[model samples]
Target: MNKSSLKVVAIGGGTGLSTMLRGIKKYTSDITAIVTVSDNGGGSGILREEMNMVPPGDIRNCLVALANTEPIMKQLLQYRFKEGTLKGQNFGNLFLAALADLSGNFEKAVQVTSNVLAITGKVLPVTLENVQLYATFEDDTCVEGETQIVDYSKAHHKMITNIRLEPRNPKPAEAVIEAIEEAEMILLGPGSLYTSIVPNLLIDEVAQAIRTSRAQKIYIANMMSQPGETTGFTVENHIEELEKYIGVGTIDTVIVNNENIPEEYLKKYMEDGAHMLSFDAQHPIWKLIKRIEAPLVRINHEKEYIRHNQEKLAEYIFDDF
Candidate 1:
């Protein structure tokens, strides 16, 4: 098989998907990012609440990641407005919002924007509907909205039973389904387990399509658990929950961090109530899966530790696929 002809579909939201997309673009131009749209926080939340539109932050990030424009254009799009009423504003978000208004469809807006920017690969939303994410804790308590669920679950220290999308039975975008069918490999997350990966799975058709697809499915585990959402989560626990929600044996491989954390950074993370995820090699769950070590994990200038080197990580995934 010609490696360059490989078709890949990456699913998730936030910086994780963007980072993965950046790396994957190096190997194949035939890539599609099926992003989550359930975000209800920060700039995205404000826009979704006010305009009754799907959150644009994740979409914006994916766009910038896959953009094939000059370096200056990439930098410009990522620039945030830091003054006046626009403080903390993302320029790309505003551009996407305008495109949505002009095209009369969010998906179309993304396509037009990508065409204009000459993005490297396609970026798609799992669903175009304005959907909210809700969580039901193991204690039988329910919290609505992604941001609220994050806050309330943390404050109360509860186990999340499951997460669901609002508006009930949303139809996954046709483009997303098509992408799944065409993909040579499908990747699920290095993002928020609940808010990102699960939101995409909550859409029944999307989940079913993923379960049935012929593509090699890989789960890239998050390096660290999110505070309220996945606290104390082990690598096995993450995969187990995903299997429970989607389907058993849906994932063919698991990529995990093998790099050790520095004591200084580990101490700071401990202070912040977070810790690096552990991969116990002898664990029963580990026995049943294919594990790959990602050894270049480090803190970037952003002050947060990311999974590993992007291009090198992509090389690992590509080799497996």
Candidate 2:
């Protein structure tokens, strides 16, 4: 197959999905990012409460990643205000809110934004309902709202045992199932295990479509454990957690990072109680699925951060595909 023309559907939200989109867009214009909208935190929550629209933060990130615009335009989209009542709010989220008002709906605003930016492919919210995310800790204590879940988990040092969407089984967004049906490849995540990735699957129709699609389903492992959310989780632990919702035998492959992180950066992550997610060769999941481990880490000295090497990661994914 001509990989450049391959139809790809990527699932998840937050920086990871967009980060993957950055690399995948470099290879294929036929990309569709299915982002989560259950975010009730940060600038997104405030805007969502005020605007009564789907949170635009994740959607905006995906649009910027796939955008074919100038660097300045991208910067403008990502720029956040430092002062005023709107301090801490993202310009892109506000842009979407304004577009929502003009377009009469959040979905239409996303579509219009895509056209204006001339972005590659499409970005679809998994569901249209104003969903709430809830997580039950291993101690069986539960918390409502994405923000509270993270804050309480960190404050108490509790592991999340379960997470579900309020008003479960909300309808999937239009064309979402169609995109999955038409896709040649479907990528699950490299994002926050509980909030970014799982909520999408809670929508019955979307998860069902993914299960029945002919597309090769790949779950990209996060570069490291989410410090508070998925602390101490291994690659297999993530897969098992995912299977709790999607069922077994759904994932055909798992792609993980095997590269060594620089000690200085590793120490920084360690300070935050996060660690690189490594694999156990003897894990039984290996018997049922294909595993690809490669050097996928890239250091950003300017930002003093480490992230997936987008181009390298996409090359490896397509190579496996």
Candidate 3:
């Protein structure tokens, strides 16, 4: 069978989802990336309030990952203004914003951008409705907006107890449901658990579609915990949280990173209260679902960063499961 003929629907936001898309696109061209739009921080946030449009940062990264454009074009898309009021703003995001304005519709702008880039697959925001992300910490104090959730949790040193989309039930894009139904395999995560992954599932229609789809549901576990969001999380804790949103048995497999991090490298993350995900094989969750443990981390010495080894991850997702 032509590998590119396989249908895949990846749901999440941030670099995690975009990084995975980079590798997964090598395996299949029929991918539908359902990205989160609740980010209310940094460049995306600034544009969201000012433009009255879905934040374009996450969407731009996904589009770039799947793009078959020239290296110069890629560089151009990633360029950031070093000074002036746009100091931290990403050019790709601004480009997307301009497209959205010209088209008078965000999705249409993305579609036009996709065509211009000659991307391998489609990208869809999880929802079209204007929505805000809200979170209540274990202390019962709630905050609105995605960035506020992190900042509040950090300031008060509290674990998040729950999160939901503002306005309750934001309707997902029509393509979201169609992609889920056509998907041969549906993948979630590899992003921030609450703000990135869960926010997408918070859409009632999107969650229900995943629950009812016949596709195999898999989760790509994060390599390290987020400082404020998942300070002490273990692999099981992550899965438990996911189950709360999507229901037990909705996830059939989890891809955990068992690769050891160098103590020197681990020190940097540890300083920020993040560490490699700890997993217990004896846990009962294993009896209910399969776990694929491998060296998923790909380190960049020059850049001093770590990301999933895209090719290896994609290979395992196909060969193992």
- Pull out the clashing pairs in model 2: none
lDDT for model 2, please.
Answer: 0.90
Candidate 1: regions farther than 4 A off: 301-304
What lDDT score is found at residue 220 in candidate 1?
92
Give per-residue lDDT, candidate 1, residue 119.
85
What tens digits encode model 2's per-residue C-alpha lDDT throughout 43-121?
9999889888899999999999999988888898899999999899999999999988997888899998899789999
C-alpha lDDT of all candidate models, in order = 0.84, 0.90, 0.89
Candidate 3 lDDT for residue 281: 99
Clashes of each: 0, 0, 0
Write candidate 1's Cα lDDT for 36-79 as tens digits.
Answer: 99888888787788878889999888998898888988888788
Evaluated against the true structure, the overall lDDT of model 1 is 0.84
Flag regions of model 3 displaced more than 4 Å: none
- Candidate 2, backbone clash total: 0
